[model samples]
Target chain A: MKTRIPVAVAFLSGFLMIVAFFGSGEWLSMLTNEALRYMTIVAGFSLLLGVVSITQVSWGVVRKRGEDWPYKIILLIALAAMTGFGVLQGITGGTVFEWLFDKIQKPMMATMFSVLAFYIASAAYRAFRARTVEASILLVTAIIVMIGRVPMGQYIYEDLPSVANWIMMFPNVAVQRGIIIGAALGAASMSLRIILGIERTYMGRG
Target chain B: MANQGNKGFFTRLQNVDRRVLFVLIFASVIVPLFFPLKLPVPVTPETREFFEAVEAIPDSSIVMLPFDFWPSTLAETEPMAVVGLRHLFRKNCYVVGLSNVGMGGPSIADRLLDSIGGEFGKTYGIDYVNLGYKANYQAVMLGMGERIEDIFPTDHRGTPLSEIPLMRRVPNYDSVSFIFVVSDNVAVDYWVGLVNSRFGVPMGAGVTAVMAPKSLSFVQANQLVGLMGGMKGCAEYENLLGYPARATRGMDSQSIIHLLIVLFIVMGNVGYFAAKRKAKVEG
Candidate 1:
């Protein structure tokens, strides 16, 4: 009864959304619009779910004195402090929140992102060996794209940028379109299966 | 010590400490910044198209600039956002700034608009307004097509959208002449699908370098009227704007890093081949 009722609701909602998209009925528009608003509100609450999950995980780590437990404690503290300040004074809460974000979060994000350069360089050096004919082709293509994408490539060879643009415009676009189309078809099929009650994975039985 | 003959130079090269590689990459990126290469930034057609598209917007036409990236991508996309905002403000276009990514985005937009708007002698709530962050990108986007105020009742600072002077003139996609989403992720696709295709609003993208290749099809199909790809794209736009900024300064470092990575790959392959030959000889 539980599964059946949820499936029926999903089907009805999905069917109405389709109608709202295709049909011109004013009620259909209102129904879909309200549904969208509901979905947004639901999504907003899901963020709270994320916060709760993080808190639970962090608390468990600290309570157990797990590896790097101090970091976990710090994480919980920062999270609570940020949320408290944000709720009390809002994002524009001036000095404290702004200072925390700019001084701590912003720099941390930047540092993490910056470390990618070193890692990418290391990974490339270790992995980009031309072991096979296919790998050789890939290596050459990658080098060409790298050169072509930057200004130095133009300095080195006037036609390099054009060649790079051609590669991106033709071969890259062809592949990207294929992936997009495949994903869209897959998503459509999955949506159809869900609406028809053939896909009950979301109900935790699959 | 006896097996040292088998440990050829190539094998040794293959075992180079990773720390050394890191240092090389770091130096390659950092040193070039101090010593500017001043290489010519050959503008791509896509970037040129982006600039021309923004330039062609008739004066006082509204533009929707959606900030859709966090600080993780601030390095790549922020410059584009800065230059894009500058271009719009320079054109005297009425701009509406919003963020769908969360608090980070709206704050970034607020700062960008405040810094850039002042130079253009633009006033908040009049020439430009920041609608701030809203949840559910699709819902917000679709709702905006129907009525923007329905989705964003207030600006980031809690000011009523109705009270904003610019909001009176621009209510939805119909009023906006151009929409550019500066994103680190697939939010550009949402803008393309929801806003542009459905509402017929012309759209552009300022995306991270990693995302540039994926967006080529949209540009080719004219679904995205223009694309500014990463920091390079920003440098091109800055050149067009005649205000060389961070993106321009960083290009030298970017160029050197690319070359360093390429050189690393080539060197690794050389070592690989040498190791293979050494193994055959030993056998």
Candidate 2:
């Protein structure tokens, strides 16, 4: 009953919203808004669940004597700091609480992305070998573009830029559009299953 | 093994070493940027078709623009958003912007909206209103179709939606001419499913290059009104909007990266086939 209840609600709510689009009823909007709030509450609870699960794992790591366990402690500490700061901010709308979000959170995300620069470069070195005709063309094109973007490619060859330009404008655009359209159709099918209550994986098991 | 039998040039070319292809692609991409390859990019009927949708809508027609990409995708999306927004503003359209990605999305949108909207004397709530990131994309989409304000109870500025003149008159998606989904993730799919399929709203999206091929399928099915894909899409958009901005620059960067990938692929394949030929002859 508990599992079926959520599924039923998802199905009915999906139908109501679909109906709302065609009709001039004011009631559907209110019902949809209520559903949005309900979903938000459920999403919020996931944060608590995540925190509790992390704490339990860290406690286990502390209990067990293992090398590199200090990292687990660090993870738990950071998690606690973020959770505490967030809760305090919510309780008392103050500037200091906002500071953690601005200073710590924002920088962490930027730094994480910057770290990818090294990873991508490493991936390029290992994977960018010219082992075939296609690889050679790719390596050459990549070199041209890489060089062209910087001061080097034009310094070496005059026509590399124009050649690079044609590839991106025509071939790349055609390929990308094809892929996105295919993926969207798949998404439509999946969402339809959810609406029809055929996809019940999202519903919690008894 | 190299794919044998009756194969066309393009199909045979597809089997080349990925790296070699990457290099060619890279050179093909980067050279244009440093050298400023001002090659003419023909604005396709699709882009013009999409531009018209937003352009034809009368000025002050409320539009919902969702930014569903982050900084990584900023390389692809920001330009599309900027170009589309500029065109909208040129038409004197009022935008109701929101983000479904995360806090970062709204943050980027906030800065961009401020800069772009400022150019047009666009006042918040008066010209545009930004609602910060909201979870439950499906529910938000549902709420938007019925009543946009109810779903976004508070504007980014913490003002109630009822107080906002735009929200009061135009309560839902039915009022908006179109929805622009600038996405690097699966967020666009959610929009298509919830809004386009359910409500028949005209939907357009900008996505990354890697995901562009999949997007074509949507275009084929007419599920999408139009699309701007990756750096190239940005480049075309730059040409469309007459900015020649980041997308143009990144197109160069992207072309270089693609060339590098292609070069490596070609090398791998050539080496493999050569080795195979040698073994067969030796035996």
- Name the regions of candidate 2 deviating beyond 4 angstroms: A1-33, A55-206, B1-45
What TM-score fits each model? 0.96, 0.71
Clashes of 2: 105
- Candidate 1 regions with alpha-carbon error over 4 angstroms: A93-95, B1-6
Task: Give the Cα error of residue B107 in candidate 2, in Å.
Answer: 1.6
Give the number of the best model, judged by TM-score. Answer: 1
lDDT of 2 by residue, B24-125 (tens): 554655566668644444444456556656566777667778988776556557888888788778778888888887546776777778878998888877
Per-residue lDDT value at B110 in model 2: 77
| Candidate 1 lDDT by residue in tens digits, A1-206 | 98999899889978876776567766776677777777667778988899999999989989999999999989999999899888877886365776688788977998999999899888998888888898888888899989998999987888999999999899999999999889889988999999999999999996
DockQ of 1: 0.72
Q: Which docking band does candidate 2 fall into?
A: incorrect
Question: How does candidate 1 score on lDDT?
Answer: 0.86
Interface RMSD of each: 1.3, 7.7
Write candidate 1's Cα lDDT for B213-255 as tens digits.
Answer: 9898899989998888889888988898798899999999989
For all the predictions, what are the DockQ values?
Answer: 0.72, 0.18
